[model samples]
Target: MTGSLTIGTLAKQAAVNVETIRFYQRRRLLDEPDKPPGGIRRYTQTHARRIRFIKEAQKLGFGLDEVADLLALEDGRHCREVEEIAGHKLAVVRERMTQLSKIEKLLVVLVGRCHGNSGKVRCPLIASLESATA
Candidate 1:
């Protein structure tokens, strides 16, 4: 490989579309190579790898902004800072899980009530939602 990959080829190597690469460039998450006079911009395997890194981070629930931060610290000299970011993300995930669990429990109880009171004039789930909002 001659490090002369076109954007389309780079996207293919990274398993993303060309527009995804463009969007990352727009967000400053990826660099936009300069095109020479009357020539096209090119990409390389490094660019593809960077796109993969962004995609994997997203898979682990990091937002684009967080990904940008991680990218900024990618020189391997910011381990502690990286850990702090990961720790904060873990805490947020835990809190969200706790909230979802409570919602699940409430839904279970409401669903059971609805089943038990089938054919009633009002649905227990609907009543619960209306009262909660009120």
Candidate 2:
């Protein structure tokens, strides 16, 4: 909020770990500034906002690549294009939710079958996975 922030301050303001900020820099999601003479790299309020944006996007299930595209579209010129991307992401999310629901149901069934069983048999979860692979 004052001058540029150090990495630790930025991470604290963004409510993220320092390593997460470093990871984002390595992944090219966040910009790394040039270090001054004998000083470490400094981050700005913009960098903290960007880190928060990336975390929120990820929490919503957007992949880093998709988040990058979303970030690129934040300039207001690409509103329509951003809408299209969001729509596609929504469809993908729905499909994944459906698949996960099915898996959850199967897991519930498997747990029920395992209750009170004393035999040293193979895990139902592993068996189900193997059968699906086949």
Candidate 3:
């Protein structure tokens, strides 16, 4: 918030846990400041901003490794590289969405079959699942 902050303060500012800050430091996503003799390590608003950036990227389905790549290209000179990475992620998301849509259609059909059953035989949903495994 102010000029300098501790790790806890930085995590609070970034809306993450203190351990998350340390993990980021270990992951090389955030820089760990040197501690003075008998004193605590200080963090800056810049560190908080970096954590927020990592979090936002993750919320958009970027893994930590991908976030690391994005961070490496944060300098404005690498827009093309960033765009390529983002385009790839978008393609993955689109494919996953297509798969999910197919799953949803199958679920709808299975539930419909279950509803139409007269309760005189085995459950349609269960039979469908068994057949799938078979």
Candidate 4:
């Protein structure tokens, strides 16, 4: 590769779309290269790496704000800070899983009731939902 690449090449190398790169630039998460007189701007490997980092962080459930925070600490000097973020995310995921488990159990009970019924004109699931709001 050359010293720098065009936005399209950077996007291709980063496995992201051009619009995503533009959006990141608009969000101040990425730096937009200066366009020379009648010439296209170019991106460097640093830019590509930043895009990949943001994408990977997002995949791990980090929001844009969180990703920016992580990016600011990307100098590889804040292990403890990174761990703190990961810990909080893990806690949130665990709480969500617990809630989902309860919901799953409730759904199973409702579906089982529906399957076992032969006489009741009122659906137990519907009745439960309607009564809960009333």
Per-model TM values vs. the true structure: 0.59, 0.57, 0.59, 0.56
Q: State the lDDT of candidate 4 residue by residue for 95-121, as single tens digits.
A: 656655665666887677778678654
Better of 1 and 3 by lDDT: 1
For model 3, residues 58-132, the per-residue Cα lDDT tens digits are 986779998887777774446787788768867778865665666666688767777867764433445544443
lDDT of each: 0.81, 0.81, 0.80, 0.80
Report the CA-based lDDT of candidate 1 relative to the real structure: 0.81
Instruction: Choose 1 or 4, whichever is better by lDDT.
Output: 1
Tens-digit lDDT string for candidate 1 (8-127): 889888999999999999999999999898999988888988999999989867799988877877755467887887677768778656655666777877677777566754335455
Model 3 spans > 4 angstroms off: 75-134
What RMSD does each model have against the real structure? 6.2, 5.1, 6.2, 6.9
Better of 2 and 4 by lDDT: 2
